[model samples]
Target chain A: AQTVTQSQPEMSVQEAETVTLSCTYDTSESDYYLFWYKQPPSRQMILVIRQEAYKQQNATENRFSVNFQKAAKSFSLKISDSQLGDAAMYFCAYRSQSAGGTSYGKLTFGQGTILTVHP
Target chain B: DAGVTQSPTHLIKTRGQHVTLRCSPISGHKSVSWYQQVLGQGPQFIFQYYEKEERGRGNFPDRFSARQFPNYSSELNVNALLLGDSALYLCASSLAGPTGELFFGEGSRLTVL
Candidate 1:
């Protein structure tokens, strides 16, 4: 079993500033993927960024990036140049990359952190 | 390209009643997964189907069931609905490889009374 935890329930950032959302997970599997998803008032979950456990380098997508600490089992999402569109519920998710039918297309998610961006 | 789409954007149901939600995956996408998002909570995985076969299921009870069709679209059926079942049902679709990069649809809001 795997579990993801987002300690911060809510976060706020001024427009054009940066903010980081904390997330931690407990997993025994070595090979996996970590993701940050954003859900706005529209109620659609949008993928923000992804990090591969095998690579030590963090993933960056335009204004979104991640700080993935494998040993600490921590993956945090950092939003740079935050905009009003970035204000939403952010979720930290985990997925197993295990082969041979052990798992498939299943994502375990954290409670979520509500991010508010203000100008 | 159209992303995943769900039908019956909003509906109301009562306890012990049954409900069915439909999803249409992106064209040529053969994988469709369902998730439930409660207010103030993250989306929870419900089921995943690939190539019209059940590939994975979550910790939900048997009353929650789903199936995928030949067209790669899917349906989620919830029997004996409970108030706790009131949430946004989301449909996500992935490409032919690892299901990590998922495209989601605006969910169907189900309110159980």
Candidate 2:
């Protein structure tokens, strides 16, 4: 079984600054995917960025990027130039690569970190 | 394109009652997954269906059941609801391919009294 953990229960960053949300996971599989999702006040879960375990290069989506340490089993999300709109609950997720249709895209999520971008 | 959509934005149910929630996948998406999010917690996987077949199920009890339709839409049914069952039910959809990202809906909030 794979499990994701976000140690930080809450985080705050000043506007125009940067914030990094920590995430760690326990998985025996070598091939898998890591994802960061954001849920705003509207309660809609939005994909932030994704990292493929095979790819050593961290995933970057504009201001949102990840420091993916596969060997350390850590995948942290970094939001640069944070804005007020970035205030939301962020969740870290893990999914194993589908093999022979065995495990498709089931996501195991972390407890989540509540991020507040203060102006 | 419209993202995933869930019906009954909010629902109130009594203990031991039954409830059904619906989800419409994004256009062209062939996979639909269900998740439960309790207050102040992350969403937990409940079920996943692709091509109108069950692909994966979480550690939920038998009271929780779900199925996909020919149109790729889905329904989640929970019987004998308990206070512990009160949570936001979310629906996510993705293309039927390896390593595809999921698109989520606003979620249906269920409050069990």
Candidate 3:
């Protein structure tokens, strides 16, 4: 089974600054998917970004980018020019892409890190 | 297009009671999955249904059961509820394939008393 870890239980960043949320996973599969999801006070889980294991270029969505280190099993989320709206509970998730396996499409999530963006 | 939709946004039930949560996947999506998210914690996978069939299940007990309808909508049924069953039940939908990207619903908050 694959497990995602987010060591930081809570993180804070000033508005207009940059912050990085750490994430690591334990998986034996070489091909899979990694993701970052954000849940705000409204309690809605939104997808921030995603990274495919086979791709080394990293996945970026505007202000949200990921530093995916496959060999080291690390995938960290970087938020640039943070805004107050960026404050939320961020979770790291993993999914297996193995073609005909029982583990396919099951997402394993981390404990989540609460991000606070102070104005 | 409408995103995944879950009914009964909030509900409270006592111990040993039975509860059912419903989900309607995004249009054109043939796959739906259910997850449980406790307060201050990340979502935990429960079950995944594709093409009206069970594809995967997490470590949850048999007390928790789910099924998908012909319209791609799904329902999660929990019997003999425990206080530990209190959580936000989330429903996610994605295209039918090996893809991992999923669109999530607002979730149904269940409080077990």
Candidate 4:
């Protein structure tokens, strides 16, 4: 079984500053994917970024990027120039890339980190 | 393109009652997965349906069941509901593969009294 962990329960950052949310996972599978999702007060889950375990390079989506250290089993999300809109609950998720019979589209998520961006 | 959509944005029911939640996948999507998100915790997988077939099931009790329709729409049913069953149910859809990118619906908030 694969499990994701988000150590920080709450985080705060000033507007225009940068912040990093930490996440770690335990999985025996060599091929997998990592994702970060944001949930606003409106309760809508939005995809922030993704990283493929095979890819040594980190994944970056505009202001959202990830520091993926496969050897350390760490995948952290970094938010640059944070805005007030970034204030939300962020979750780190894990997905298996196995083929055939094990092709369930299930995502194992971590206990979310509540991010607060101060103006 | 329309993302995954769930019906009955909010539902209230009493203990021992049964409830059903519906979900419509994206136009070209053939995979639909259901999750249960309790307050202060991350969402937990309940079931996954692909091409109207059951692909996977989580560690939920037998009272919780689900099925997919020909149109790729799905329904999650909870029988003999208990107060512990109250949570936000979410439906997610994706292109039929293992890319791991999923579009989620606003979720149906179920309140069991």
Candidate maximizing DockQ: 4
Better of 2 and 4 by DockQ: 4
Quote the positional error of residue B45 for candidate 2 in Å. Answer: 0.6
lDDT of 2 by residue, B1-113 (tens): 78889999999999999999999999999999999999999999999999999988999999999999999999999999999999999999998765778999999999999
Tens-place lDDT digits, model 1, residues B1-113: 88889999999999999999999998988888999988888889999999988888898999999999988999999999999999999999887555447889999999999
Task: For all candidates, state DockQ relative to the true structure.
Answer: 0.75, 0.76, 0.68, 0.77
Candidate 2 regions exceeding 4 Å error are none
Rank candidates by DockQ, best first.
Answer: 4, 2, 1, 3
Question: Which is superior by lDDT, 1 or 4?
Answer: 4
Model 4 misplaced stretches (Cα beyond 4 Å): none
The 0-to-1 C-alpha lDDT of every candidate, in the order given, reads 0.91, 0.93, 0.92, 0.93
TM-score for each prediction? 0.97, 0.98, 0.97, 0.98
Q: After superposition, how far is residue A111 of candidate 4 from its true place, in Å?
A: 0.6
Candidates by TM-score, descending order? 4, 2, 3, 1
Instruction: Identify the runs in model 1 with alpha carbons over 4 angstroms from their true place.
Output: none
True contacts kept of each: 0.74, 0.68, 0.60, 0.62
Report the error of model 2 at residue B99, Å.
1.6
Candidate 1 TM-score over all chains jointly: 0.97
Encode model 1's per-residue lDDT on A1-109: one tens digit a residue. 9999999999999999999999999999999999999988888888898988999999999998899999999999999999999999999999998887654578899
Looking at model 1 chain A, which ten-residue stretch has the lowest summed lDDT?
Answer: A97-106
